[model samples]
Target: MAQRLVFPDAYAAADLITFAGRAARAGDGAVHLRASGGTLVTAAAPLLRQGLLDSTPTIIGMRLLPVDPELDCDLVVEAALLQIAHDDAEAVELPETAVPPPLWSAAEVPRSGWSHAGTLDLAVLAERAQWGMSAVAHALPIDPGDLIVQAVRGKIWSAPDEDLGGLPRGVAFVARTLGFIGEDAEDVGVRTCGRWTRLTLRRGHVLLRGPAHLGMTEVRETGHVAALVD
Candidate 1:
């Protein structure tokens, strides 16, 4: 039998599906769903690795949704499949069918012990994200190949910005793309724990692993614990 996510209400279920769809359109189609106890952490990769040696930073857009305390799981599934499952269901339950995601998607961000790094204005984040998007659009040729697109994106997003806590512009790009940063001129929290950095906003969160972070190393060395602390 396929596992299902039982949300508290119809609105919550619909919200998760909508967020998943938005995330898929921004990046790849896969969304990682991990539920434990009363919280369901839904995440999608906005920046991804094209190959094993690809030095691109692993940036993920994540949202925390409420669910029934009894339901617990960890799996990756296609956002489109998730929406289809929701549409076919009669109640506020999301059915899951496992789909393997890219290897880099396996790198987990630390859940606890996040110290407040600093704060960034939402307007700044939005502007940076827009700039990166525009840069990629202007640099890509008409009908560009997949490799070329990835290369251009990697170069643009991976470059660090000293003004934004020395984080890559991709961080802002992911936050904006995932709809985490809103039109309000409020400041968002930046937190850090070990090699993981989290941008906390009212709508959702964006988790990022440092450039040196690798999926295989975390899986093998930490026994899949994803503890990348030095």
Candidate 2:
């Protein structure tokens, strides 16, 4: 039986990248950030970190490749271990073992602008996730339905008065719920995108941001409630 993990949002990809980049950096490994066919490998934490943070929120396919053929089977295992340790990830998938080598590599790489694939996991990613979440949660709170937004350009915005500071409690809760955290309050922003509300913040604002997509409903649902009230 093959397990399929579908991440139908860009935020999901960004989350993976951030998790992977941090793991790679911490282990003194390298990360190659390529969208189509351009392999831009770098070891700079700031650059890779920013790439993960600034990624547009959309759905893209991600395939994890192994650095070596012998390590192929351990790809998913490594990802799970990273998630368990980091607490910044939820799920991952493994490729079919019987697939042809060339095709497997091809599918793992993104084409045009549809999906992306790569390999990582040379170090202990779990600890990085744990520490990152701790740092983020320490600064904010976590809540269901909170929209994680980024502060495109600004400083720490004072938490709103009236107990609406928008921060959450646990770092793991925030990591599991909001894909990424901002560096500070001013770097976080909560906004609604289409049907899904997004919490856009820097890598550090994980806790300080709050939900921005409450009470939202489709036109049909809204009309039904209106009729009932009338």
Query: Where is model 1 more than 4 Å wrong at Cα?
Result: 1-3, 84-96, 211-230
C-alpha lDDT (0 to 100) for residue 162 of candidate 2: 19
TM-scores for all candidates: the values are 0.83, 0.23
Q: What is the C-alpha lDDT of each candidate?
A: 0.72, 0.27
Candidate 1 local lDDT, 136-217, one digit each (tens): 9999999999888888988889888765667888988888877787776666767677788776777887788773222111
Give the local distance difference test score of model 2: 0.27
| Candidate 1 least-lDDT 10 residues | 215-224
Candidate 2: list runs displaced more than 4 Å.
1-18, 21-34, 37-172, 176-179, 204-230
- Range of the 10 consecutive residues with the lowest summed lDDT in candidate 2: 221-230
Q: Relative to the unseen true structure, what is the C-alpha lDDT of residue 194 in candidate 1, on a scale of 0 to 100? A: 79
